[model samples]
Structures are given as C-alpha cells and as structure tokens.
Target: MGLWDKIKDGLTTDKGEVAEDAQSQADNAAAKAKEAQDKADAAKKDAGQPDAPAAPAPPAPEAPEAPQARPADEHKPKRKPHREYTVVSGDTLSEIGARFGVDWHDIARINDIPNPDLIYPGQVFKIPNK
Candidate 1:
C-alpha cells in the first residue's frame, strides 16, 4: 500500500519477503518516474521548446562551452583583437562589454573614454587583444 505501511510490514515480515517487496516497489517507482519524464520531454518538443539540459543545436566550434565548475562571467573569454564597434544611440559601455564578452572597464581603458556613460552615437570603440 503506502510507504509507511510497507515499512511496517517489512519490519515484521521475513527478511527475504521484505526485500522482495521493497525491490518491487522501487522498480514500480522507477518506471512511473521514467514515464512522467518521457511525457514531459514529448510535450516540450511538441511545443517547440528545447530540452533544458540539452544544447538547442550544436554551436560554432571555435566558441568554448560553459564549464560545469565555474559560471561567473569573469571566466568568459575576452574579445578578439582589433575589433571596432560603433556607438549607437542609447548604447551604454556595459551593454557593449556584454556583447563582446569583455569587461566594461577594459573597453574604457582601451578607448580612454573618461566616462563610459558619455559615448555619443557614431563614435567608434576598439576591442583590444585578450
């Protein structure tokens, strides 16, 4: 029946019988969990949603994958050398940094922009070497 009742029965019954019953219950639980997971995966695929733990599609080979141990952005790769980005209206240095995978302060140092907030449209920013 229930887990508690099963446990009680297990405690009072022969060791072999209790072990057999417990094994059966565990197998049934495993089967149920597998069925539920399969259904969820099917629903996600039907709705055009990718599996959370799986890559949506294989990405470019040169780009490195996120390491399992570290997730901090600081560990992300730096921007390639000599790349130039033009400042657009409403663009902030922080936004630019995120796009190029570099630190905002690094961009400021390379461009010598006294205030990262003070960039004007059509101004060019350089992405320095890693």
Candidate 2:
C-alpha cells in the first residue's frame, strides 16, 4: 500500500484492534525505521559517498541573567502585557479601560473593534496590563 493509504488505514482502524498486540506493533515500527535507514545508507554508498556522521546533540539553552538594581526615582514605564477580558452587560470601552488602568482608544485599537461604542456582551477584548 502507498504511504497515505497505510496512514488512512491506521487512522480508520478500531482502537481495540490497535491495543491487541502493542509490543509486536512497537517492534515492527522499530524494524521498519531501521530498514529504511539501512536502505538510505546503501544508496549513499552506491553513489560513492562516505557514510554520514551521527547527528550531534543540541546545545543547552543559557540561563537568564539577574536584573541589575535601578534607582528608586527612575520611573520608566515598562512595556505592559495584555490580558483577555470578556465584555458584559452595561460595559463600555471607556469604563473597561478605566477599570483596567488602560486608555479606551488603546483597548479599541488592540481589539480592532470596528465601532468603539458598539461592543456587545460576551465579546472578548485584550485589555492591556497596568
């Protein structure tokens, strides 16, 4: 069978059928993978190419450095994050913005609401963090 047909058959098969012989299935999968790898190596050898090197392990990610101390008076506004807020009855963009310490225009811009004054209940908006 073609690869796609095999994939479709696998997907359409009943779960009970798959669970019947799990160990044998796993062994078959490993054998198939090893056979495919062997075929690829043989093809490369036939083309007069040297055997490919084993893949190297990925480098570990560096740990983040600690933040330096800042002056108490240095009050630079950090870039605020956003949180999703669902609109409720009697809620307006201005009131929502006021409650969240964000500008009404910013709320409208972020959410791409066509009409700033036409928000309905259950509509979700990304409210910027204070």
Off by over 4 Å in 2: 1-80
TM-score of 2: 0.39
Model 1 lDDT vs. the true structure?
0.86
Clashing pairs in 1: none
How would you encode candidate 2's per-residue C-alpha lDDT over 1-130 as one tens digit per residue?
8999999987897878768778778999999987888887899999999876545478899989999999886797656488899999999999999998999999999899889989999999999776
Question: Judged by lDDT against the true structure, how good is candidate 2?
Answer: 0.88
Model 2 residue 24 lDDT?
Answer: 79
- Choose the strongest candidate by TM-score: 2
Alpha carbon lDDT of each predicted model: 0.86, 0.88
lDDT tens readout by residue for model 1, 13-95: 68898799999999999999878888888999999998655325777679677777856876788656669999999999999
